[model samples]
Target: MKKLLTMFITFFKIGAFTFGGGYAMIPLIEAEVVDKQNWIDKEEFLDIIVISQSFPGALAVNSSVFIGYKIGGLIGAVLALMGVVLPSFFIILIVAHFFLQFRNNHIVDLLFKGISAAVPVLVLSGIDKLAKSLDKSVDNLIILIISIVAVTIFNIHPILIISFAAIYGILFLRKKVD
Candidate 1:
């Protein structure tokens, strides 16, 4: 019971404090779950990030639910989900009511601009952390380069790229012993 409450509170704090959406929340989620709580290890967290991004819905929501389920089963998943979602829900409600009034205000405009500027930096930080976690093998590097080109130059969908990578790993990346 106590652990469940803690999970709920932790997710609620994350959902409440983060401003730049799912990618921005990655650092905080890693800090809390991997570094602070030890609820999940770094490798598992990375796997969760990959799996979360591969699916639909917000990354924050999917990752929170996966961590919650891993830690505390179905109930945990529900609580973690609710914790992460409620803050945004309430904030959006409040913003919807009040933002129109403040929309044209100079200070409000500046505030939003400042926040918007910070979002990309947060995303880059998350990417750096994830990249550092990966094994720096040449095969991985080649795959990374190809994936980047596919996404940036060819405008390929990430799900398709991930699916191809998974299939390639399954078919050819296996280690063999004599």
Candidate 2:
């Protein structure tokens, strides 16, 4: 019971404060879940991030659910999901009510523009952390380069990229125990 409440509160704080979607929430999640709470180690957190990204749905929600289940089963998953979603839900409701009124406001426009600029930085920071955590091997580096090129230059869908990567990993990266 206490653990569930703590998870809820932690995720609630994360959801309430974070903007710019899941990528932006990565560092915060890492700090709270890994550093502060010691719920999971950095390597496990990284694995969660990868798994969350590979699946459909928002990364933050997926991660919350995964962590919740790991910590406290089904009920925990629900609590964590609610905690992370409630803030966004209420904020959106309030914003939707006034969005029309502020649609033409210059200050609102400027604020949004600033947020747009900052969102990329947040995502890049997450990427930097992920990169640092990755195995510093030639194969991993090659895959990373290929993935970037496929997504950016060739415009391949991420789902397809993930699929290919999974297959490649299974076929080539697997090692047999003797």
Candidate 3:
């Protein structure tokens, strides 16, 4: 009961306040869950993030639900998900209700301008989290470099990039000379 309330409110706060979306929320989640509340350790948090990324669905919400469940079982997952998403859901509803009329407002414009500036920071944080989570190895490094170069320079379809990577690994990395 008490834990459920805590879960809802904490996620509610996260959903309500943070400026950026999933990536931005990562740092905030770390602060609240890892540093402040001690709900999860860094490794668990990272593992949850990884699992969330691998599966289909929203990353932050999925990770929060998993963490919440770990902490307080089924009820915890429900509460954490609510905490994480309720604010965004409501805000989107309210914003959608009036967004067209509000779009031209000077205050709203400035607010969006401010929010746009935060996106790069959010991306950096997301990258940092991924770096921390992934195993450090030459193969990983090479794959990262090739992916970046292919995406940035060639502007290839993502599917092609994934396919090539998969094929490269299967043909070369997986085979051993016996």
Candidate 4:
């Protein structure tokens, strides 16, 4: 009971304060769950991230549900999902109600600008953390370079990359293990 409440409160705070969407929430979630809460280790967190990204929904919501389920089963998943969603829900309602009135306000514009500026930094931090967790193998580096090329140069979709990577792991990496 206590654990569930704590998880809810933690997610609620994250959902309320994180200015950007799922990518921006990554660092904050990592801090709370991996660093502070000790709910999951870095490797598990990375796996959750990959799985969450593979899913079709919002990254933060999907990750939250997975983490909650891992920690506290079905009920935990519900509470965590609610905790993370409610803040955005309420804030969107408030914003939708008052946005017209504040549309022309310079302060509001500046506030948005500041938040937009910070979001990239948070995302970069998350990428850095995730990168540090990966094994320093040549194959990983080759994959990383190829992925960058595929996305930036060729403009390939991420889903395709993930699929290829999964297949490579299953076929090649599995053989190495066996």
lDDT of each candidate versus the true structure: 0.94, 0.93, 0.83, 0.93
Candidate 3 deviant stretches above 4 angstroms: 129-134, 153-178
| C-alpha TM-score for every candidate | 0.95, 0.95, 0.79, 0.97
Error of 4 at 145 (Å): 0.8
The order by descending TM-score is 4, 2, 1, 3
Q: Worst 10-residue stretch by lDDT in candidate 2?
A: 169-178
TM-score of 4: 0.97
**Native-vs-model 2 lDDT?**
0.93
Give one digit per residue, the lDDT tens place, for model 4 in 61-152: 99999999988999999999999999999999999999999999999999999999999998898889889998888888988999899999
Tens digit of per-residue lDDT, candidate 2, span 30-93: 9999999999999999999999999999999999999999889999999989989999999999
- TM for candidate 2 is 0.95
Worst 10 residues of 4 by lDDT: 168-177
lDDT of 4 at 37: 99
Query: What does candidate 3's lDDT look like per residue over 9-91, in tens digits?
Result: 88889889876777778877887888888988888888787667655678789888898899899989988998888898999
Worst 10 residues of 1 by lDDT: 169-178
Clashing pairs in 3: 11-83
Model 3 has how many clashing residue pairs? 1
- Comparing 3 with 4 on TM-score, the higher-scoring candidate is 4
Model 2 Cα displacement at 116 (Å)? 1.7
Superposed Cα deviation of residue 4, candidate 2 (Å) = 1.0
